[model samples]
Target: MELLGLDSFNLVVRHGGFGAASRACGQPKATLSRRVRDLEESLGVRLIERGGRSLRLTDEGAVLHAQTASPVEAINDALNDIRAGLGRPSGRLRISAPILFANTALGVLAAKFIEAYPDVILEISTEDRFVDLAADDLDVVIRANPRPDDTLVGRCFMRNELVLVAPPGLSRPARVEGSAERLTFPAVMRMGTGDDDVWTIIDADDGLPRRYHPKAVLRLSSPLTIRNAVLAGAGAALVPRTVVAEDLASGQLISWGTASGPEIEVWVLHASRRLVSPKVTAFVNFVCDHFNAPTR
Candidate 1:
């Protein structure tokens, strides 16, 4: 249980400098330096390589850090699991997610989590851009098709299926075929990442994927704007199942095609650490359990 020293090392890597790490960790620079030195002496291998004013991890340090992070995080998760088993979740949980998901899904889950753990502080940020969880002081990031680094941890939270939806005024094409199916009205595209145009549908009977190419009319990264546009009678759109759930339930929008579509997996991600304290662990467990609930 080299918990304390491993945490300091992880902080130094996250902050990129001793001074910044000291400030973030609320420790004096001298004290942090001594702690790291003691850790190096205890391990008999240099963890941080001096790079003028900045510090870089030695090859051995990188491997050691990576190997130790998950266990540290698991320790933290274990503590939280114990606390949750006893019916108490008390800690701070920081989260970041896409604007659409943050507003629609996480908002509800966060509220429920806070209610369950009244002593826990749930900080959430809604940004479409990606943030480094370790560096940005973030505990978890919910992302679609998240590709975590070797030093990070990822947990799939939910599965997302993309579907084409349009306003009531849009006309249904007489013949819908393969990826080249031509629709009469222009399509509103969620222009995030480069794969917006590559719309796919899954064959319900065979459970195989089929692609579709729509006539592009509007291209924007904001899913909210696309939803609003579709609601205001712009055109058809390929959007997340969660994003359109309420509107579809309310009959504001309708599913466009018969074939099913591609599935985008959503994940909860966090930095790899040697020791996950009670706070971080509790949050991860709570989030996973919350999202994995029967209603979810």
Candidate 2:
């Protein structure tokens, strides 16, 4: 339990500054700073150094961090093992997911998981930004681009692919004679979500990079708006395969490419905790299995 405070300290150190750490932790900047200071007071050592906006671990703090990290993680793992032996998991499991994945994959998987573990109450949060598992108490997070931190364990569960899609009847813009290889079309950019619509494609014929940078006609944060714009034939768009799977299957959307598509990876990450807990472990296992299923 004492390691929990140490874990929080670890986050601030890793993120480099309190503002960034607070954003990751989903806590007010002042509150996170206070908590860190309180933890340092209890430890009787100054663990972090403040240089205006910059942060660095003290010499003693770095040594203590390195020493305690692995053992704290192992202790948590051991506790989780003890809980799982009791059988059915019963507790609250909080999960965060990307907007596209949440709209597409989570629906069926979540339903089945909840049904199998009735005692587990699921709290799901759909956000485009990276979720803070430690402060938010999120059991797991489904992130598009997985970034592992010192205080978190990440597991890649499923594979995804990015495909350029447009409305079924939408006509490809007429390519200029010399610019046929490179075309410019109006596109809806993903704004404020830490992503852009730059399409990345690889040619299987040759291991060459064929990048497509569509001219963004509009920038938006809503995936639904992007989909609607694509459907309306406003312009071409690159969306995740999972999000537009049914559309692709039903011919409502067409995948535009001469070669293969971009590689997409799905990862589930969890913060280092005192224990994984039965509910979190069960839920993680369920998501891993369900997404990797042959039919899914």
Candidate 3:
């Protein structure tokens, strides 16, 4: 069987259809269809079952794809490595990130990375949902730990401290005499999938952890939304320090100290640590190094 035909078939499966594969590979749709058909004929078995507006792989096609996909990817990756070793990083790099990060430092870092490696085409997706790297054909993802999949490798590049904050004009009750007298205020919180309504706080003086079930005035999913609500004097919110640092500096928000919350550890995640492509490696290293460097 011709390797070219097999490669064409693989592209069709990867991109979901001949039209998509044609666009991705910069080939004509009819040409790609003919190549895949040639591959099926040479194997003496039907590979793909074409139906109304959808494509399905026959059993033979499934087996062939399962066998050939990895080898084809490895070969492409090897070529990319050679190109990269010759001095420039090139090729498409697909990344996934949360909306908050994508709107913040990630936007700046991505711009700098693209500027540094002009040949690399960067595609970024922003959402709150967890992405399956292999299934989604993603090269890298930036997210908070604990990672969803154990098979994936993650590099922790930054820590996001969670802090309780309120608007500068919001009134705070006078500090009472006892430990139990620590004030509880209405809070805007991110509603978890579970039914728990508890918030944790660390005692500023004794350094012990405390749990407070504050009355939730509003529950929302987005950190940026929660931050805005707090800034509007709706209620206090436990949020990542990065989200509110500018507000705190500008005196729009006041910090109520560290919250008893999970460490918002940020990680750069990928499917495999071994045999990573040059595009993925360059991006991961650039982000890690940028965050690791000491500030002025």
TM-score, structure 1 vs. true: 0.63
Write out the backbone clash pairs for model 1: 69-273, 69-274, 72-274, 72-275, 72-276, 76-276, 201-261, 202-260, 202-261
lDDT of 2 by residue, 1-296 (tens): 34667766766765778888888768788877777788888878888887765787899888876666544544554565567666557755778988778877788888999899987778899888866665454668888767657777756787766667777676655534445355556766567532334455553234544556678777767666787787777876766666677877888888775325436677777766446667767877787777673322
Which order, best to worst by lDDT? Answer: 3, 1, 2
lDDT of 3 at 56: 87
Error of 1 at 81 (Å): 12
Clashes of 1: 9
The root-mean-square deviation over C-alpha atoms between each candidate and the true structure, in angstroms, is 6.2, 9.1, 3.5
The per-candidate count of clashes, in order, stands at 9, 0, 0
Off by over 4 Å in 3: 1-3, 14-16, 28-31, 41-44, 51-56, 59-71, 81-87, 148-150, 173-175, 179-182, 193-196, 203-211, 293-296
- The lDDT values for all models are 0.71, 0.69, 0.79
lDDT of 3 by residue, 68-94 (tens): 765576567668768667535788788
Worst 10 residues of 2 by lDDT: 192-201
Candidate 2 Cα outliers beyond 4 Å, as residue runs: 1-85, 173-180, 192-213, 258-262, 293-296
TM-score of each: 0.63, 0.62, 0.84
* Better model by TM-score: candidate 1 vs candidate 2: 1
**Model 1 agreement with the true structure over 178-276: per-residue lDDT tens digits:** 555533557787564343355555533355555556676788878778888889887888777778888988989987643453468877767675345
